[model samples]
Target: MGDRFEKLQDRLRDWTKADLPGEIWHSVDLFDQDDYDILVVPSFSVDQQVGEKIEGFLHYEERLLFSLIRLRNPHTRVIYVTALPLCPIVIDYYLQLLPGIPFSHARERLLPISLYDGSLKPLSKKILERPRLVDKIRRALRPNKAYMVCYNCTELERKLSLELDIPLLAASPDLLHWGSKSGSREIFAECNIPFPDGSFTVTSTEELLEELYELWLRQPDLKRIVVKLNEGFSGEGNALLDLRPILDYAPDKCERVETINALDKQLQNLSCQAEGETWESFSKRIPKLGAIVEAFIEGEVKRSPSVQGYIRPTKEVEILSTHDQILGGADGQVYMGCHFPADAAYRLKLQDLGLKVGEALAARGAMERYSVDFITVQHPETNEWDIQAIEINLRKGGTTHPFMTLKLLTNGNFDYDTGLFLSQQDQEKHYIATDNLQKEQYRGLLPNDLMDIIAEKRLHFDSSSRTGSVFHLMGALSEFGKLGLTSIGNSMEEAEEIYERVEAVLDEETKNYGDRASSLPLNWDKA
Candidate 1:
């Protein structure tokens, strides 16, 4: 098995370095390709505990990316693998949205296979456990050149590629460390990019405490600090501390006892990333996965803008898109959704920083998609924003699906120079997307029911005006009462308006279903 795995790695290298395929290049004319095959594996690819709650619906939400299959030529096949079967109605719903493609033709070319298990384990693990399912996938391969695309690549993904005799079009698992919080900070420094004042790769609470004290000494007026898990996603492994109380005392008066006491108190009261998580549980996790403590960049005029980029196998770095993330939580540290192309005022600056980071990643042999997150603050005196590179996600993140949805649906490209998305028809495009439009009343509502409401209310995307809502997380709605959506329009205001209308429609339709709203705090915009 080890020898076979090594052989598979060699094949993957050859595939990535193979001669050019004009059709595979992502552009407005991607559909013009004559023949090819794309096998999409939308695994959460995170720790099992982090993905536990949403295991059943993770792949279902990725169906949003399947919208790209609609753009493929009839001769080109798309194989979408999932942990469980997708709702046929949901499949039909997306197929009907393709502008000029006939539903039957597209459906015939698209294939969805599942493992028939909805357990809390990672989808890759589930696939590995089901040998019959793996064999089924192996048997479906065509003679044409193919590429395996995943939500993120890890050890399990590498194993799956060997089993299926396919090469992943992503970074090798050996490069996984580059995506961690500690690695991100190192990369930032190596590239000469500006980052926050913090210490990374701290393995214990003691080390973290020492680092905090060091930072406090450097900046006596520090108000807060953030401690993050090296591998946590969507802010679930993040915790914050208030440093104001400790700073209140003079240097001689500030004793270690007093400092530790204050730190303990703040940690116990932190707003953890996971629901129902206590300081006891979170503390245990910190040592196991490692953590980083950094001085929180605070300002009344602060914003979190992220830049998405990709390095092809050939080492060419491409800036994909930028977003102004809408954060939530007590200190606005958790990710919600985002506005596409970021805020026009500083998007170009964000892109420049992103490029520096991307070049560094490419130099290190990183491939496929990665995103650099930043915390930008306005200078009170000059009104100029100073951007601080926060962390790098070497995988698909909250911004990936939304941006891909817009790109595939409209056949558009993000213009890095102008910070705008232009569709194939040369129309300007924008969108507001979120995965947190969740409510208890939304429970027990199946995909079919949601489709009915969309049809009756006429909420489908309007081809004539190029505006409307597209829904995801349908599987979660029936059980978890969670739904995700992207509202696309010609401008930011229009997109936001469309999002508001969609929320209103869902609220009105599902008002009486299930119990009252969950007691858990809303993670997204409640206003």
Candidate 2:
């Protein structure tokens, strides 16, 4: 099956490069075509190092991206495949947001297929394990014009594409390294982009120690360093090493054995990427996963911003959006949310850097979407910002869906010069979004209950006003006390206002219910 999949991918590669009659190419170009088929496989096909239980919860949020179906061309057919079926209520909630399209009209062109499995495995993996589902998908495809859209491309996704004999509108698995931390660093170097001082990729603790010690020798003033996995998602594969204590040790006392032991203890005590993940557990997995040790760039006015871009099939680079990422967690490394258009002061600067890197990626055959994360700080003397490229994500991410939703909802365009999202009416748009709004007290609420609350509070988006709140990840609320929110506004202040109001309303509505009732389990147990 693997060999067959590989062979199919080779043919698809050739298909992508060759012109086909009356066929539109690429996911972004789907709007141009009146007839096409889209197979959306929202799979988190990263290395299996990240535990399955967490992966299952993550899937809850990704289902929101399928809201893309709401923007479907009337002649287009969209089949959304999930590892577990989505709640019917969740499906209706998304469909209701379609502008001029009737709910039934969109539904007629839509297909929701599921494996009915809630394991931590990738959705593509689940689909692969079930030949019946594969055949169903094959039968549903729209012949030669069909393409698979995924959360991320991997060998599993590659194989799945072969099984269906459809081209994947994502970077090939072979090109994924361009999105990894190590790969990002290499690209930064190739493109002459400024990046944090970091050591090359290391596979074992010994190699990590060697890199860190070497970096320390070059810059003894380095106080902290970040150790990251090549494929860490949302900072779960990252750990910060406090180098102060180790650096303070006497030169005479720095025996190789003592140094390694001290560093080992420090690594063990360092933070783990996910909840319940211990250094002991994470450290054991580092050797097999590979890592990079880099000096942690710090400053008083530091901010993390990211630039998202897309490479068209014709090798043109399109700068889609920029974001001021909201980071949380002990070290402020985890992805919490983001503000659109980034900060006006440095938005264009970030865009320039993003294009330089994106053009390099386009030249390298990276297709579809990719984003670059950056760390910027204000210099005390000159008040100028110093920016360092941190990493790149070669797939859809936390920032993807909200921007996509806004664009689809309003048929807007992001202006490169002004750093503003302009709607069809030419009004400036802004939004505040987060995937981490979890409260232990809100555990017992059901999807229906939340929708009722939203209605009663007038929280539904108003097409006329082009402003309101949209909820996602409602499936995780009862069990995980988690829900995703995106509050859109005409200005930054307005967006923040909506987000604050929504939070207050949710708190008030669910206040009593959280303490009194047990959350109702969905059809299946959450991992």
Candidate 3:
């Protein structure tokens, strides 16, 4: 139980911060100080270097963690992985919504450039500033190749990688094709699987309305009409186009239907709720970079599974696990959290489908660690299970380390004979990092701040005193914060319990900072 995230994108980005509660790693300072090579990161274009604003992106700190291994052993090589073009349209969306950003001025005239999320930027924008950002990095990291930009292999990525002489990871464009709603539709059709009837693309509302009519004609009992962007994430760029009440468009062409007046009434009703994300605004937010659209399916959220595979040598390993995205609630929030394997009933099926999908993707020139998400539902009439693809995240997903951390911590072995991920008696329990540091400001508190707080909260883990009933597995915190201070414990419950304890410590420190701010020195204005 850690910070819950409202959006999945938020969750992936926040994991880089140091104070993530429940995580075993205490401080990022240790990670920074450690000498290593090959730092994997998100848009090194936005990284901070040894102060001085580090002037142009370098590497996301999380991927930079590998510097730890390299520092310990210089023979190590690091590979940073990047993903698809976010969307080539979201740029205008943000400008329209939050006009304060610098890019707002030129938004109106941003022709020939669509938005793409986090794909660095649209080709046009990148073309404008590429020289400056690239030049800055070239100067800063020139001596011995400080870092490499593992961009997704889109046309831009390919061009950039060639110019920089750095190896790019999964090409965004090709992988993106696998993630399209239409792509998924094709896959479903080939597999003879059932999915919500959907249009390949709907550029205008006219086409949208027409598609709605067609779907209605095909399946009159359908209750939900999901609208999705060509490229999107989490649940963004999606809406339920409720057409039940407003189905009178082109009534003459079909059997008797609701009148035009009813359609107008429905539009009026929609106007009341239309204040949220608009098509025009939502369209631009598509990504100053890359995005895809899809049909939104209705059902309980299920199976946040990822099938991990690596391609330099081409190996496929499907670690099918269920995940709960920790979307820190509204406002500036933290995004990250706990993931475990899927439920018993559907675990096997999920893993199997994931393998099939993963292989299919890898075969189509997208042969790396690709993740495909799906939701399963039962046909109302047949009661048969149906697993529908959600979106394919063809990159290293959140499930990467949680499962690996579990592997590193576990001493037990799995039994292939039993077709189980672990042996029958293999012990599997322990961990805690759900320490919420945001509720309370993380003021000037040092590493020991949390340990002391957990002690006060009576949450310290003592291996010798630990009973299998309370806690059973363990590791020791060698440093504990910043530059690699580690925390170890036995039992997942104990790990979680300790996290809660230290959370209060963060809260306390934040409160102290608040007090200090209010009572500052009166003569402090000399500067």
Candidate 4:
């Protein structure tokens, strides 16, 4: 079945190559009034166990709702599939953001299909299991004129693409290794990119221990090491190992067997980044998912910045944007959100390094969106930032939708020279976005309730000014007290102010409902 599936995918890839025009692949305007059908299956398609750990994981499907902006092209139709039906209010919210296009006209070209199954399986797999749903999607799409887009591409996505006879506008499942922790390290080495000292991929507790010991030998002064699952996302699969307790087992101070034994004993003390994660549960996943160990780069002042880029079908690489990510968790490893147009000092440097990585991936046949994360530390003396590559996300990630939303809203383009996004009116645009605006007080606010808040506060994105708030993850609000939003403005300070205002408004509205206040800072500087 696997062999046949691969052959089918290869054939489909060839057909898609011949069907789509080369010029469309390189153009900044993706649809550009072109006649085409877009099949959107926003499936995470990750390890179900890991995915289930996230609160309101299914609602993440709404992240790609930004794709609805493509409907503005007039000649394009979109078919969006989900595990469960989306709220009409949520759909209406997105459609209303379209500039110049009439609401009824855009709705006419849109089709939102739901499987009515809220099971934990990937949405693509659910669709595959239902022959009727598969057929429904196939019948909706125009043969030879449509392509599928997803949150991430896996074997399930490939199978779905084959079943629908539509090409997937993502990297093939076979090349997914490039996105894994070990694969990322290999690419960094091949590209001569600087990364933390790390171990090769390991699949067993014993191998992991040996690698940890070796890493300790190399960096005896290392205070901490990060253990990451090869296939983790959003930093959930990461754990930190404190070396202070095992300092006596150092290479110079102790023998090999003693050091190894001490390290093995300390495994139970690993500080996991994921909520409710334990060393026992984490280590159990090693054999199935593989793991790696790397020295944790430590500094008094550090920033997590990432660069997003795209690999066109023509194999040309384009840097899309750069952002300074806001992280949280025990060790500041979990992704919370981001500020666009990364700090001026290193934004261009990020683009240069990102281009190298993208070119490398494109040379290896990677396509569509990819992002490179980095750890930048400031030098006390020179006050210059030292940058080190971290990992490669070979899919549309947290930064993708917000940047896409900004582009679609303003009809803007990323300025390569300045690393700033320029609107069609030549005004600079900035935004602060997050999928983690969660609060206990926010629960029970239905889509309609949220819409009312938006309307009353004038928080809704203004099509005329092309600045304000754009929200997603509306489905999660009722149950999880969580919502996602992108606050846009003409400058970074204004963007942060907008985000703070939104946070304040939500807090004021929900104040009487919950006991605890949100931990998120009300000011950007404090954050």
lDDT of each: 0.77, 0.79, 0.38, 0.88
Model 3 C-alpha lDDT per residue in residues 186-228, reported as the tens digit of each score? 6656655445566675655445555655665566555545555
Task: Put down candidate 2 lDDT per residue, 1-527, tens digits, no spaces.
Answer: 65665555454456556675544454444243345677889888765666442533545535445445434667777888877667788888888887677888887887888777877777788889989889988998877767788888998998889878987777878888888889999999998899988877788878887887677666667778898887787888888888777764422357656766677677766766577777677767767777888889979999999999887755678888999999987899988899997998888988999999889988987778899999999999998989999998889888888888778667788898887899978999999998888887778787888887888789988888899988888877877878888899999999999999988988887777635544455553663
**In terms of lDDT, which candidate is strongest?**
4
Best by TM-score: 4
Q: Per-residue lDDT for 1-527 in model 1, tens only?
A: 55675555455455545575752444211334545567778887776666653423464435435535434576677788777778888778777877677888888888888777777677878888889888887878774356677877888888998888876777778777889998999999998889988887888877877777777767777888888888887787787776665555423458866766567666777667567766777778777788888888888899999999988766778898999998976567778789997988889988998898888888887877899999989898999889899899888778887787786678777797898999888899999888777777877888978887898888888877778988877766787787778899999999999999888988887776554564335563563
Off by over 4 Å in 4: 1-22, 27-31, 513-527
Per-model TM against the reference: 0.90, 0.91, 0.57, 0.94
Off by over 4 Å in 1: 1-23, 26-34, 53-64, 67-71, 248-252, 512-527
- Give the distance in Å from residue 3's predicted Cα in candidate 2 to where it truly belongs: 10
Overlapping backbone residue pairs in candidate 3 total 77
| Shift in Å, residue 296, candidate 4 | 0.2
Pick out the ten consecutive residues of candidate 3 with the lowest summed lDDT: 467-476
- The Cα error of candidate 2 at residue 266, in Å, is 2.2
Comparing 1 with 4 on TM-score, the higher-scoring candidate is 4
lDDT tens digits, residue span 1-527, model 4: 45665554454346436556555554323544556788999998887778877999999999989889889878899999988789999999889878789999999999999889888899988999999878888998887778888999998998888888777788888889999899999999998999999987899999998999999998889989899999887899999999898898887799999999998898899999888899999999999999999999999889999999998766778999999999998899999999999999999999999999999998887888999999999998898999999999999899999998998888888999999999988999999999999999899998987887888888988878888999999999999999999999999999999999999999988888566554445684666
lDDT of 2: 0.79
Assess the local accuracy of residue 161 in candidate 3 as a C-alpha lDDT between 0 and 100: 43
Q: Estimate candidate 3's alpha-carbon lDDT, on a 0 to 1 scale.
A: 0.38
